[model samples]
Target: MSTTPDRVALVLGGSGGIGRAVSERLAADGMAVAVHYAGNKGRAEEVVTAIDAAGGAAIAVGGDVADENDMRAAFEAVETAFGGVDVVVNTAGILILKPIAEFDLDDLDRMHRTNIRGTFVVAREAANRVRAGGAVVNFSTSVTRLQMPTYGGYVASKAAVEGMTLILARELRGRDVTVNAVAPGPTATPLFLDGKDEATIANLAKAAPLERIGRPEDIAEAVSYLAGPARWVNGQVLFTNGGIA
Candidate 1:
């Protein structure tokens, strides 16, 4: 791909399944990347090492995404190493599935803290810090649109993400930073497949027109577009779900 040596990106949750893909993909495209992890230092280091092995620039940053001070430090770490951050992608999130009544209130609070509060903290930092012509990409879920049962709390958190994304885009005005969210359908990741049976997975996979599950790379491609050349595509949720409506 084309390389832009001057560009830099910070991928929050860069140690996780989809986050790892986005970190690697951004690094491959020649953006100096900061791989931010909440806990998995080894996984984050592996991602950074892979990028370096591929002749790309990357560093691993650790912080609590929902903590303002922690996120600020993560941003500072990137800015310190990369001069300035051109793109900020918040893929750090939590997913807990259960019927609304069946859900423990503490679990709901935890999900809200990570998924909603975390995005707010990251987006606020990106809003104040991202250079002109930069981008802020947030993660949402197709469950919001699909209205899947047992996903009420998760969907609620992501729905808050969608609202923040649109409002942030408008708030940026002429700042030239495109704010958007990517909503992906069921993907083959450990977090998603943990308790799911083959039959259930197959059914969800076939629900989409593509008749298969999405890959992390597939969602990363959408993020790449928003972060790079899709200047006019702002204030929208791009559902990269392979025609799953």
Candidate 2:
């Protein structure tokens, strides 16, 4: 509740299911949002329009998060429009599922390009440009703990994010900025539900004590906490999975 109306957030992957939820949640909480998309300008624009319709401030930005130049321009655009960037929520990622023995190296390469390289690209930008008293939220996954089959490649990328995020939190010493990651379990988003049959989905839903998969808004609530009221929290990977772990 200490958040102000002027704080600005650049939500990378803001066009996707979970990312859209994060963007809207941040805007609703009073921050002007720059909804960043990789290749979907229209999807990003839709989020911006929704925020505008809700009487909140928002704009859409485009970039490949794995590219440093693109991300730098993204930060510059946000700073120019909003005067400064205070929060960065990177919900951007790629998830490819296949058994490790059968996984293609090219798939791993592609996933790492976005899920790992892309995350750090934005992290570096936020560290250099985010104003004081800002927040940086990275995304992780509960599957890193679940050790689920066919998730090895995807989990590897997120685990890297978890490591880099914890280290970055300490590296930002004296900057008064908080860095953290949220790990959600089997969220019912396109990212999590795609390519799965009903039986697989049902099994995942029952894996959690909550007896259901997470909602995008459920995960967004955790990001809102880290990005807004939970200043004392830092350098941690929060498992926002409804006790799936």
Candidate 3:
């Protein structure tokens, strides 16, 4: 709890499992927040309501993360409501898991469009609109390092995100903006647990030294650091996976 009462943050995919955690966490730290949802305005509004119930300021925004025009409007809406945006966190992405051989080309294209293209679209707006001393936090996956099977497509998309984040940090030189990506291991989110059974879950949980999977709050804490006081930690991928490496 330290508070940045004057700051503002826009969290893409703020309605989802991990994204909701980040949105609420940022709000708890006194940043006015815009919760961006892909299509579920109701879910996004629920997160906003929760933040407001907790004495925080938040609003729901909706857009196609991969669409340039849609993302541009999202930035405009936040700027209009909050005066300026200080942190832009992109957690809006798609995950399609299949072996490269079994993956449909269309699925690969869709995943890249949302995960890779969406990240850059948000970054493009943040590059011009985020205030000085702000941060752009993108989401990646620990599977990129873990090299898990059946995750080739998903990992490819996130790997692109890692590269994009690193280069964006360097490109923002002299702008006082820190660009970074958070790569989280298997977290107990609905998305992660959908097709998994107890045995598989147990195995993943034990893969890390902590003897458990990550929590959304755990990942949010890393994002909170990058968005707040970690000024020198730029151009890097912080794998917040409880020593899974």
Candidate 4:
């Protein structure tokens, strides 16, 4: 919400379902976007193409959020393409759902690497580099509040993100930057729907007060609001879960 006109935004994980939506929404809102992806270069290019077709400026960049060098290169690429970045939206994360007792240690490592460590790396970079009057929007999950079974690992990772967002918001006090997180509920993304049966998915959708699963755009709308106009909304986790949490 603290962004300036003609500002640039870097969307980490811009190739995924929610990430693509966030990239498009930010572009529509008139911000030149830097679309970042880790493994999906083609999908990242697709997002860039859409933005360009809409007469918006965008470029696709690749990096792993957990690597300092990778994120540094990503930021450098954004600056090279759009002068300097004013907003950073970190949607790059992994969700590994399993009972704690049976959860694979390797899976735990992967989730932490991408969700917690990656978020910290990106947030630290944003804290030091983003221009004044900028905004940093991180991703969390509503499962933290719902405490759903088999979501222990994923929720724990996002909880780290939430804590970091609050601390960073205060850390950016004199710099005129706002840091927040968007906690979305069960959304209809490939990541969320991959292995579910029709009946199970329908039941989950009906559980929300809205009686439908979230769309990526629904979450993107929240990101757009926090990134552009909600100047006083720092240090908050805006949940876009349709009242499920």
Candidate 5:
């Protein structure tokens, strides 16, 4: 394979499962990654150390993705570290499951704060700071399509993410940046499998044609492709689910 150019990426929530995988994958693919974490600096540092051990470049940055000033500083830190950023993958989010009638207003607010407003803040910074030919990848969940009963609030927030992703692509018409979302199905992450029983997990896995849960690496592969070489794929929500639809 030909060598990849010197590129930089800032992955929000890079300390988490899917985010960490994306951080490692992008670094392996020859990009200097800025691993951004909201509350887990140690985990972010671990990712950076692992990348460095593998002869790749990475740095740990911390901030609230919902805070504009914080996210702006993050973008600046990445630019200062690696010249400029070429890709931004926002994996920062929160999940609270409850029936619509049983949902606490506070829970709905929190979910929207991270998943909706947080995405806008991150995308705003990326829109202004990312170099030409860069890509912005946001995260969504396949639950929006599955339309499960208890997923009302969670699915609502992701629907907003999908809307913004497509609109942002149109807004960046001349800048050559691709804006997209990755809506992953049931993945085997701590955040995903936390409260579920084995039986429930098995049912979800079997629902998909692949008959298995998605690995963090599987979603990371999609992010890597969009960040590096999937230029023609713009303004779309790529469902990395195993044919769950």
Candidate 6:
């Protein structure tokens, strides 16, 4: 693992399940964390409270990742609080599931705006601002590989992230910064498992070789690994699923 004693980390979408988990993990690993949320100030504050309770340094900020001005301001907030950013984790996204024929154009635009454009906004900023030996981690999903029905638009958006990650990694060569993505399968998060019946959830779990759905912590573990220990890993889309795909 490569680490600077006083490095800072920024997590976009830090109020959601996977984002919150990653924020806590990085803070535990000794980085001051700036937790960014899109809408829920309360949820973002909750994550900061948890980190503070655990004796880790963290603060909450709000921004819409798709907006460049908002993202720039969020970075400014992080830099002001913790010096400068060394790690950036983007987990902000929206999922609207429907068959293609029934898909709403409005929903499609919203998903693309957040998932694809937001990723670029953050990545572009990180590429220029992150210090030497910093890391940038983007989020993708296993559904891109699973090709599940009714996920065409969502998967398509994430696929753009995957492509961008590879190009960014190459572009950052010799900068001593690693860029990568984590793709988790069917995690047990509010966004993922909120309304499913027990039987349906269990069946989905059984489909994986691990016979259980993933936890936010499971995905967080992967992010921590890449952000800290996996210095040689770059331009990779790590599938953090339990061999389901």
User: Candidate 2 residues 1-245, lDDT tens each?
Assistant: 22235699999999899999999999899899999998889999999999999888998999999999999999998887888999999999988889999999999999999999999999999999988899999999998998988999999999999999999999999999999999988899976777889999999888889899899999899999999999999999999998989
Report the error of model 3 at residue 139, Å. Answer: 0.7
Candidate 4: global Cα-lDDT? 0.92
User: What digit string (tens of lDDT, one per residue) describes model 4 on residues 90-163?
Assistant: 99988888999999999999999999999999999999899988899999999888889999999999999999
Superpose all Cα atoms of candidate 5 onto the true structure and report the RMSD in Å to 1 decimal. 2.2
lDDT of each: 0.93, 0.93, 0.93, 0.92, 0.93, 0.93
Could you tell me the lDDT of residue 200 within candidate 2?
92
* lDDT (10s digit) by residue, model 3, range 1-245: 22334899999999999999999999988899999999899999999999989999888999999999999999999888878899999999888888898999999999999999999999999999889999999999999889888999999889899999999999999999999999999998899899899999999989999999999999999999999999999999999999997
Clash pairs of candidate 1?
none
Give the Å shift of residue 88 in candidate 4: 0.4
**84: Cα error in model 1, Å:** 0.5
Q: List clashing residue pairs in candidate 6.
A: none
Candidate 5, residue 162: how far the Cα is off, in Å: 0.5
Off by over 4 Å in 2: 1-5
Question: Candidate 4, which ten residues in sequence have the lowest lDDT sum?
Answer: 1-10
Q: State in Å the error of residue 110, model 5.
A: 1.1
Cα lDDT tens digits, model 6, 161-193, are 999999999999889999999999999998898
Model 6 worst lDDT run, 10 consecutive residues: 1-10
lDDT accuracy of residue 3 in candidate 2? 26
Candidate 5 segments exceeding 4 Å error: 1-5
**Clash tally, candidates in order:** 0, 0, 0, 3, 0, 0
Cα deviation at 169, candidate 4, in Å, is 0.4
Candidate 1 has a TM-score of 0.97
Residue pairs whose backbone atoms clash in candidate 3: none
